[model samples]
Each structure stands twice: as structure tokens, then as C-alpha cells.
Target chain A: MKLLAALLSGVLFGVGLAVSQMTNPAKVQAFLDVAGAWDPSLAFVMAAALVVSSISVVLARRRSQSLLGEPLQIPAAATIDLRLIAGATLFGVGWGLGGLCPGPALAALSTGVPEVWVFTASMLAGMLSYRWIFRVAPIRE
Target chain B: MTEFTPVSATVGGLMVGLSAGLLLLLRGRIAGISGIIGRALSQPLGDGGWRLAFLVGLPIGAAAVSLATGRLVVEVAASTPVLVAAGLLVGFGTQLGDGCTSGHGVCGIARGSKRAIAATLAFMTSGAITVFAVRHLLGASS
Candidate 1:
């Protein structure tokens, strides 16, 4: 049941990416294109997503236990530090240049676009490099 | 005659929300691109299989959708060097922050994670600034 639910969710997320035209790196780049031919459509999509997500969360919490038979795991930290700021900046630059973040980029691969693979490969390398550089301690749930 | 369907942003958003929520509920994991990609990179014993499956599935899903609807549009205006640099930076950031927007902004916030809230705020601010600098200052565009 859990596997089915997770898979279903993944499919739904993919569908959302498709319908929003977010799977298209061009549209995302348009949003980043502030100076010439700037497009704010992605903002609208994000805003719409935020509203729905906020509401769904409120309702979902009313349940005693989630469908997978476990409580929701929330992050324990609360402060904003150099790590957060630096990370955000890095992520933003990537989004601006590549026009693909993790979700959409991964989704784009299914389309068999060569660029997507290149982007994903680099992203994976980046992720791995972090473990070596930062030496992240094992995260305990 | 073909039926006229409304482009429901609400429905689209709801579907995305549900998908993220469901993943959290079942896998005890946030549907974060960075984190998923991160785990895939480690290639730990018994790890690569699922990660490979997940990674492989993403592109396949898009391909299937494109086949069903129409061709998927892909645009990359940045030079290869710039794209590579950006990818490296994001990887560093995802690691330092311990989560991406999907994990923090969506999943973490939903679970009432204060850290996620802070991280999400930082993510948005940086994104806005990058847009300003690249588009306004540097003259980069799609």
C-alpha cells in the first residue's frame, strides 16, 4: 500500500509538472528572463501551488496517522545560518542557468531529452561532492 | 465536438500537493530533487537499485507524457560552462542546507518544521535576487 501510494504520488507530481509547462525549461527560463521577454507564468504556478499545499497540509494534519502508518517527520532546526543562505544562492543560480531544478529536471529525463541527462549527471556529481566536502554526519530520524 | 476544459490551477496545485504529501506519508521522505539525487550519487549497497529506478523513471514518465500529448519542449540558453557551474553550486547548497525547496518549502513546512520555513524563505530570497542580477544586471535570458 505504501509503495503504491508513493508511486501514485510520483505520477501525480509528474502530471502537474507536465500541465504547468514546467517540464519545459524554456518556460522556466522565461521566468528568469527579467530584462528581455520576461515571463512571470512560473510565479503564478508557484503561487497557486503554495496556496493548495498550505491548505492540504492543514487538513492532512487533522488525521491521527498518515496512510503509511507513521507520523509526519518534520525538520527539527529553526535558525537561518550561512548554510541556508549559501545553499539558496547556489540553488537559485542553478535554476537561473539550467532552467531545471531537481523535480522538473528529473521529470524531463523521462522525455529522453539529452540536456536533461547532462543536467542530472552534473547534479548528481554535485550532490556527491558535497558529502566529501562537508562530510555530512548521518541524519537520524 | 471536443469538450472545452478549464485550465484549473487549483486542480494542478492540488495534485502536486497530494503527490508530495503522499510521498511524505508513505516513504517518510520528502520528494526533494536534491536529496534524491544526493542519495543516488552515494551508490551505497542496496541503494543504487531504487535510486536508479527512481532516476530512470523520471525521464520515462516525461517521455510517455510527451508521446501521449505532444513533443516536450526543452530550452537551455546558458552556455555549458555556466550550466555546469550552476549545478555544482546547487549541489553545494542542497548539502549545506540539508534540504531543497521541495523538502523544506513543501514537505517540511507542511509538517510544521520551523527550519524548513527559514530555509524556504532563504531559498525564495536568493531566487529573487538571482533573477534580478542575472536578468537585470548580467543580461542573461532564456
Candidate 2:
């Protein structure tokens, strides 16, 4: 049941990415380009998402257990750490450079584009290298 | 460049939110792409069945969307090496930050997390700055 729910959620999320043009690199890049050709379409998407999620989170937090009788898994860390800022800054540079993030980039894989292949492979390698280099479990900071 | 797809964008945003809401309501998990993927990579012996399932669904859902709508995402014009470099940075930085666009930008902000707010601000500012550097200063048309 848990697995099925997750799979369905993923499907819905992917479809959203595709339909919202979040999968479009140029659109995403344009959104980031305040100093260049700016596009504000993504702002609507982000706003809509935030509003709905906010409602769900607020309502769900009122209950101790989820619909599946599982304990809520909200992130516990509250500290504003150096790693978070630095990593986010680096991620932003990457995002600006390629106009790709994990979700949209993964969805792009279905298009069978070569650049998508390169980015995806490199991302996987990057994830693997984090494991190899640090030898410590990656945790939220 | 305010692309006028407000209708579709809002509808799609609702779907994204619905999916995220379902994940949180039914499964009690954040529907964060980077965190899920990163954990899947770093934890070989950990629970990952759902993560793999979700990951598999992403492409399937994308394919379905394209088939139905007859609209495909724009081909990213960056060179292979640049794409590779971008991917590496995204993956590595996300792991270090413990979240990415979906995790922090959507879910974290929705919950009014102070740390998440700060992180989101940092990333957005940096993203804008990077865009300025690449698109304006470097003059790359892609």
C-alpha cells in the first residue's frame, strides 16, 4: 500500500512537471533570468503549489498518524547551518546553468535527449561520489 | 517573457500539490525528488522500495503527459560537458544541503520552517545571480 501510494504520487508529480512547463529548460531559465529575458509563468505554478501544500500540511499536522496509520515524518532539524546555505548556493548555480533540477531532469529522461542522458549520468555519479568521498551518511543539516 | 499559460500552470501546480499532499497524508513522507534520490543512493541497505517506485513513475508520468498533450519540453542547448558539470553540482550540492527545489522550496516553505525559508531565499538569490552572470555577462544564448 505504501509503495503503491508513492508510485501514484510520483506519477502525478511528473505529470504536473510536464504540464506546467517545469520540464522546459528555457522556461525555467527564463524564470531565473531576472537580469535577462524574464518569465513569470513559473511563479504562478510555484504559488499554486505552495497554497495547496500549505493547506494539506496544516490539516495533516493536526493528526498524529497519517491516513496509513504511519507517524508523520516532518524534518526535525531547525538549525540554519553553513552546509545548507553553501549547498543551496551551489545547487542554485547548477540550476541556473542548466535550468534543470532533480525532478524536471528525471522527467526529461523520457524525451531520450542526449544532454539529458549526460546530466542524469553525471548526477548519479555525483550522488555516488558523495557517498564515496564522505563515507558518512548524508543527513539534513 | 511572462509566458501566458496561467490556466495550465495552475492546474498542473494543483496536481503537483495534490501529489505532494497525498504523499504526506497517506504515506507520511515528503515528496521531495532530490532527498528521495540522494537517500536511495547513499543508503544501499535502507528502505528504498518506495523511492525506486516513485523514481520509476517519474518518466512514465512524463511520457504519458507528452503523449496526451503533444507538447514536449524544450531541448536544453548546453554542451555535454556543461550538462555533466551542472548535473554534478546539482547532485553534490543537494546532498550537502539536504534538500532541493521540491524539498525546501515547496514542502519546507509550506510548513513555515525558518530554516527552509532561509535556505529558499539563499538558493533563489544565488540562482538569480548565477543567471545574471551566465546569461548577461557571459552572453550565452540557449
Candidate 3:
């Protein structure tokens, strides 16, 4: 049952990526191309998504546990430092160039574009390196 | 007269929100792409089945949609080298950040996580800056 639910949720996410055209790297690039021929469509999409997400969070928090009987996991830390700045820089530069992030990249895998493989491979490598480096001092769980 | 039927962005938003909710509910996991793929690669024995299925299903779902609705137009405006570089950088960043946008922005922020909030802001701000620098400072485009 849990497996089925996970699969269904993934499918739903893919469909959303498709319907929103978030899967298209070109559209994403256009959105990023703020100085040249800026596209506002993605902004509208982001705004709409934020509205839905904000409301959903407020409502979901009323309950102690989620529907599946697990407590919602929220990040504990709030302080910012060198680690935060550097990570954001890397992510931003990547997004500016690659035009796909983890969510859309995974969703794009279904599209069979060769680019997905490249993105996925690099993303995995990055994660692995993180694990190895943090083996002795892992990120707070 | 009135032929325009607006596809509610809310439908997709709701789908995303619901997916996050369901993933937490069912698997006791966050629907974070980086974390999911990371775990899938590292520990074959750690929650492997569903991760494989979910990752595999992504492409298949898109393919099925293409077959039914017609091929979704794909265009890579960036050069191959640039895209690859971007991928490597992102791969490195997710490690440093400890989570991707899905983990921090969508799932974490929704759960009232301050760290997620800070991370998401940083992510967005940097993304905006990169675009500004690349398009304006560097004068590169595709």
C-alpha cells in the first residue's frame, strides 16, 4: 500500500511538471533570461505554486500527525553562515546554466532527453561526495 | 465567443502539495529529488525498491504522455558543455547544502522549517543573480 502511494505521488509530481511546462529546460532558461527577452510566465507559475503551498502548510500543520501516521519533518536550523552562502551560489550557477533542478530533472527523465542523464549523474556524484566528506561529521538529521 | 479555458495552476500546485503530503504519510520520507536519488545510489538496501520504481516511473510517465498527446517539444538552448558544467556544479551544491529545493523549499518550508526558509531564499536570490550576471555581465545566450 505504501509503495503504491509513493508511485502515485511521483506520477502526480511528473504530471504537474508536464502540465506546468516546468519540465521544459527552454522555458526555464527563458525565465532565467531576465536581461534578454524576459519571460514572466514562470513567475506567475511560481507565484501560483507559492500560494497553494503556503495554504497547504497552514492547514496540514493543524494535525499532529499526517494522514499516513508519520509526523511531518521540518528543518531545525535557522542560522546562516558560509556553508549556506556557498551552497546557494553553486545551486544558482547550476540552475542558471543547466536549466533544470532535481525535481524537474527527475521528472524530465521520463522525457528520455539525454540531458537528464547528465544532470542525474552529476547530482548523484555531488550527493555521494557530500556523504563521504561528512562521514565523520554528518549533517544533523 | 469564449473559447479560452484556463488551466488552473492550482491543479498542478495541489498535485504537488498532495504529493509531498502523501510521500510523508506513506513512506515516512520527504519527496526530495536529491535525497531520493542519493539514497538510491548509495545503499541499494536502503529503501531501494520504491526509489527505483519512482525514478523509473518518471520517464515512463512522460513517454506515455507523449505517445498519447504527441511529442513534447524539447529544446536545449544552452550548449552541451555549459549544461554539463551546470550539472556538475549543482551536484556539488546539493551536497554542501544538505538538501535540494524540493527538500528545503517545498517540503521543509511547508513544515515551518526555518533552515529551509533561509535555504530557499538563498537559492532564489542566487538564481536571480546568476541570471543577471550571465545575461548581462557575461553577455552569453543561446
Candidate 4:
């Protein structure tokens, strides 16, 4: 049941990404390009997503167990430390360079674009390297 | 500029939110791609079934959309080297930061985490600055 639910959610999320054209790196870059010809479509994506998820998050917060009787796994770390700031800044620069974040990149894989494959491969390498170097388990947040 | 797609974007956003909500409500999991992928890579031994199912569903769902719509437009403007660099940064940085746009931007914001908010601001600002440098200063075509 849990696996089915996760699969369903993943499908829905991917559909959303493709439908919104968030899978398009050029569109994402345009949205980030404030000084250039800016497209505000992605803003609506974020706003609308927030409206729905905020309620869900709030409701989930009030409960210890999920509707499936699984323990709630929402992240509890609230520290605004150097790691968060530096890491996010670095990720942002990379996002601007390629305009491909993880979710959209994964969704775009279905497009059979060679660059998408390259990016995804390199991204995985980077991730594994981080683990290799730090030897720390990836955080669950 | 790309064609503004407010309607599709909004609808898609709602769907994304619904997915996140459902994952949280049903499985008690945050729909964070980086965290999901990261953990799946790190801990491939136990509890890999749901993660694999979810990951597989992403591309399949996207393919379903492409089939239904006849086309899914995706233009990656970055060159191979740039993409490699970008991918490395994103992967390593998300691992270090503990979240990406979906985790921090969507779910974390919804939960009103100060860390997520700060991280979002940092990324957004840096993203804009990077774009400015690349497009405006570096004279790269968008």
C-alpha cells in the first residue's frame, strides 16, 4: 500500500512537472532571468503548490502518524547555519547555469535528450562523491 | 522569453502539491527528489522498494504526458561542460544543504521552516545573480 501510494504520488508529481513545462531548462532560466525578458509563469507554479501543500503540512504536523499508520518523517532541523546557506547558494548557481533542478531533470529524462542524460549522470556522480568524501549518510530532509 | 503558461503552470503546481500532500498524508514522506534519490543511493539495502517505485514513476509519468500531449518541449541551453559543472554543483550542494527546490522551496516553505526559507532566499538570490553574470556580463545567449 505504501509503495503504491508513493508510486502514485511520483506519477502525479512528474505529470505536473511536464505539464507546467518546468521540465524545460530554457523556461526555468527565463524565470530566473530577472534582468532579461522575465517569464513569471513559474511563480504561479510555486504559489499554487504552496497553497495546497501548506494545508497538508499543517494537518500532518498535528498528527504523529500518517493516514497509512506510518510515522511522520517531516524534517525537524531548523538551523539556518553556514552549511545551509553555502550549499543552497552553490546549488542556485548550478541551477542558473543549467536551469535543471533535480525533479525537473528526472522528469525530462523521458524526453530522451542527450544533455539530460549527461546532466543526470554527472549529478549522480557528484552526489556519490559527496557521500564518499564526507562518509555521512544523506540527510532525510 | 518563453511563452507565459499561467494556466498550465497553475494546474501543474496544484498537481505537484497534491502529490506532495498525498505522499505526506499516506506515507509520511516528504516529496523531496534530492533527499529521496540521495537516501536511495546511500541506503540501497533496506526499504528500497517504495523509493524505486517512486523514482521509476517519475520518468514514466513524464512519458505518459508526452504521449498524451504529442510533445513535451525541453531545451537545455547549457553545453556539456557547463551541464557537468552545474550537475556537480547541484548534487553536492543539495547534499550539503540537505534539500533542493522541492524539499526546501515547496515542502519546507509549506511547513514554515526557517531553515527552508533562508535556503530558498539564498538560492533564489544566487540564481538571479548567476543568470545576470552568465547572460548579461558574460554575453551568453539565453
Candidate 5:
């Protein structure tokens, strides 16, 4: 049942990404290009998403366990540290360069574009490299 | 500029939010793509099934939408090398940050986490600067 729920969630999320036209790199770039011709469509996406998720988050906070009896595992880290800033900045640079974040990138894979495959493979390598260098289990957020 | 898609974008955003809400309410897990993939790769096999199921569902959902709609728009203007570099940066950075747009931008902000808010601001600012540098300063074609 847990797995089914996760699968359904993933499918819904992917469909959302596709419907928003976020799977398109060009559109994402345009959204980011504030100084240039900025496409403000993505803002509406974020605003709408925040409205629904905020209510759910508040509800979830009141519960110790999920509806399925699993322990709630929200992120606990709260510090605005250097690691967080640096990492996010790097991610943003990459996002600007590629216009593909992890979620949209994964969904865009269905287009069967060779570059997407290459990007995905490189991304996996990058993740693996972080593990290899740190030699510590990544902190779950 | 890309065509503005307020209606579909809002609907899609709602769907994304619904998915996140469902996962939290039902499974007690954050619907963070990078964290999901990273943990699935490094963790022991016993608890990895759901992660794999979620990952598999991503592409399947995308393909399903394409089949139904008869079109799935995607354009990668970056060269292969550029994509490789960008991919590496994104993967490493998200892993290091412990979240991405979905996790930090959507779930974290909704929960009112100060860390997520800071991280989102940092990335958004950084992304805009990078775009400015690349498109205006560096004179790269988009």
C-alpha cells in the first residue's frame, strides 16, 4: 500500500510537471531570464502548488504518524548554514545553464532524447561522487 | 519568451501539490526527487522498493501524458558537454543541499522551514545571475 501510494504520487507529480510545460528546458530558461524576456507562467505554478501544499503541511504537522501508520519523516534541519547556501547556489548555476532541475529532468527522460540520458548519467555520477568523497551517509532531509 | 500557460501551469502545480500532500499524509515521506534518488542509490536494498517504484512512475507518467496529448514539449539547447557539466553540478549540489526545487521550493516552503526558504532564495538569485551572465555578458545563445 505504501509503495502504491508513492507510485501514484510520483505519477501525479510527473503529470503536473508535464502539464506545466516545465519539462521543456527552453521554457524553464525563459522563466529564469528575469532581465530578458521572462515567462511568468512558472510563478503561477509555484503559487498554486504552495496554496495546496501549505494546507497539507499544516495538517501533517499535527500528526505523529501518517494515515498508513508510518512515522512522519519531515526534514528536521533548520540552520541557514554555508553548506546549504553553497550547494543551492551551485545547483542554481547548473539550473540556469541547463534549465533542467532533477524532477523535470527525470520526467523529460520520456522524450527519449540522448542528451537527457547523458545528463541523467552525469547527474548520477555526481551524486555518487558526493558519497565517495564524504564517505558518510547523506543526511536525510 | 515562451507562451504563457497560466491555466495549465496552475492545474499542474495543483497536481504536484496534491502528490506531495498525498505522500506526506499517506506514506510519511517527503516527495523530494533528489533525496529519493540519492537514498535509493546508497541505502540498503530492503527499503528501496518504494523509491524505485516512485522513480519508475516518473517516466511512465510522462509517457502516458505524451500518448494521451499527442505532444510533449522539450527542447535542450545546451550542447552535450554543457549538459554534462550542468548535470554534474545539479546532481552534486542537490545532494549536498539535501533537496531540490520540489523538496525545498515546494515542500519545505509550505512547511515554513527557514532553511528551505534560505536555500530557495539563494538558488533563485544565483540562477538569475547565471542567466544574466550567460545571456547578456557571455553572449550565449539560448
Candidate 6:
């Protein structure tokens, strides 16, 4: 049941991303191209998602366990550090270049695009390299 | 600004939020794509089944909409080498940061996590600057 819920949630997230044009690299690029011919459509997506998530998170946090009785596993890292900033900076540079992040890249997998394959493979390799080098240290539990 | 689709974008955002929110409320987990993927790759046995299920569902979910509406269009605009570099950067950077837009932007902000907020700001600024430099200053569209 829990697994099913997780799958359903994933499906919902994917559909949402697809519907919002988040799967399109061009659309994302346009959104990020604030100084140029900018597209503000994606901002609405982020805003709407945050509104719903903020409310839900507030409600869910009061409970020690989830509705399914799983221990809440939200991030527990409490401090801001150079690692966080530096990592996000690198991710952002890549994001600006390709307009594909973890979620959209995964969601676009079934499209069978060669470029997606390249991006996905490289992204996975990157993840694996970090794991091998860093030993998958839990940055924050 | 001209390519804006407020209705669909808002609806999609709601869906994304619903997914993230539901995951939190039901499983007490952050719907963080990078974290989940990393775990799926290296986590211990009996620990990665759900992550796999979630990851599988990502493509399947998008595929369903494409099959039904036949409206989804996909093409990676960047060159193969560019895409590879971007992917590698994203993959490594997300791991090092411990979150991406979803983790830090959506789930973390919703929870009022300072680290998530800080990380999100850092990435947004970096992304904007990179775009300006690459697309504007450098004129390297590819």
C-alpha cells in the first residue's frame, strides 16, 4: 500500500510536470531567460506548487509519523554552509545550460530522445562519481 | 512572457504540489528526485523498492498523458556534448547540495527549512547568472 501510494504520487508529479511544460527544455530556458524574451509561465507553476506544499507541510509536521505510519523522513540539516551553496551553484550552472534537472530529466525518459539519453546517462554518472568519491555520505538526514 | 500559459501551468503546479504534499503527509518523505535516485542507486537492500517504484512512475505518468492527449512534445535543444556536461554537473551538484528544485525549492521551503531556502536561493541566483553569461554575454545558445 505504501509503495503504491509512492508510485501514485510519482505519477501525479510527472503528469503535473508534463502539463506545466516543465518537461520542455525550451520552455524552461525561456523561463530562466529573464533578461531576454522571458516567459513567466513557469513561475506560476512554482508558485502554485509552493502554496499547496507549504500548507500541507505545515499540517503534516505536527504528526510524528505519516498517515501510513512511516516515520517522517524530511531533511534535518539545520545549518547553511559553503557545501550547500557551492553545490547549488554548480547545479544552477548546469541547469542554465541544459534546462533539465533531476525531475524533468527522469520524467522525459520515456520520450526516447537521444539527447535525453545522453543527459540522463551523464547525470547518473555524475551521481555515481559523487557517491564513489564521497561514499554517499548523507549530507543531511 | 509571451509564451505563458497560466491555466495549464497553474494546474501543473498544483499537481506537482499535490504529489509532494501527499508524499510528505502519507510517507513522511520529501519528494526529492535527486535524493530518491541516489538512494535507488546505492542504498541497502529492502530500502530501494519504493524509490524504484517512484522513479518508474515518473516516466509512466508522463507517458500516460502523452498517450491520451497526444500533446506532449519533447526534444533536447542542447547539443549532445552540452547535454552531457549539463547532466554531469546537475548530477554531481545536486548530490553535493543534497537537494534540487523540488527538494530545496518545493519541499524544503514548504517545511520552512533554512538550509533548503538557502540552497534554493543560491541555485536560483546561479542559474540566472549563468543564463545571462551564456545566453546573453557569451551568446552561446548551443
Model-by-model lDDT, in order?
A: 0.65, 0.84, 0.66, 0.90, 0.87, 0.86
Candidate that beats the other on lDDT, 1 or 3, i.e. the better one:
3
The count of backbone overlaps in candidate 1 is: 6
**What lDDT tens digits, residue by residue, belong to model 5 across residues A1-141?**
888998998999999889988888888888889989889888888888888899889899899899999899988888988889898999998898888999888998999988888888888888888888889555757
Give me the runs in candidate 5 sitting further than 4 Å from their true place: B44-48
Question: In terms of DockQ, which candidate is stronger, 5 or 6?
Answer: 5
TM-score of chain B of each: 0.79, 0.91, 0.84, 0.96, 0.95, 0.91
* iRMS (Å) per candidate: 4.6, 1.4, 4.1, 0.9, 1.0, 1.4
Q: List fnat per candidate, in order.
A: 0.46, 0.78, 0.47, 0.88, 0.83, 0.83
Please state the error at residue B108 of candidate 2 in Å.
Answer: 0.4
CA shift of B135, model 4, Å: 0.6
In CAPRI terms, model 2 is classed as medium
Judged by DockQ cut-offs, the docking class of candidate 6 is: medium
Superposed by TM-score, candidate 2 places the C-alpha of residue A52 at a distance from the truth, in angstroms, of 1.0
Candidate 3 Cα outliers beyond 4 Å, as residue runs:
A55-60, B1-10
How well does each candidate superpose onto the true structure, as a TM-score? Answer: 0.82, 0.95, 0.84, 0.97, 0.97, 0.96
| Candidate 5 CAPRI level | high
Candidate 3, B1-142: lDDT as tens digits: 0111125334555566666666666555667766676667666556547776666555555565566668665566567777777887787676677666677767777666776778778877777777778767988755
* Candidate 5 TM-score to native: 0.97
Better of 3 and 6 by lDDT: 6
Off by over 4 Å in 1: A34-36, A138-141, B1-11, B43-57, B111-114
DockQ of every candidate structure:
0.43, 0.76, 0.45, 0.86, 0.84, 0.79
Candidate 1 residue-wise lDDT, A6-125, digit = tens? 556667777777666677767766665555565666665555666666665665567666666656654466676776667766777777667778878788877767777777778777
User: Order of candidates by lDDT, top first?
Assistant: 4, 5, 6, 2, 3, 1
lDDT digits (tens) for residues B45-66 of candidate 6 = 3453888888888898888878
Chain A TM-score (model 2): 0.94
**Going through the candidates in order, what is the number of backbone clashes in each?**
6, 0, 1, 0, 0, 1
Winner on lDDT (2 vs 5): 5
Residues B59-130, candidate 4, lDDT per residue (tens digit)? 888899999999999898899999999999999989989889899999999999999999999998998899
Model 1, span B22-133: residue lDDT tens: 5655544566656666765665324324344444545555666687778766766667777777677667677667777567766666666777777777766666667667
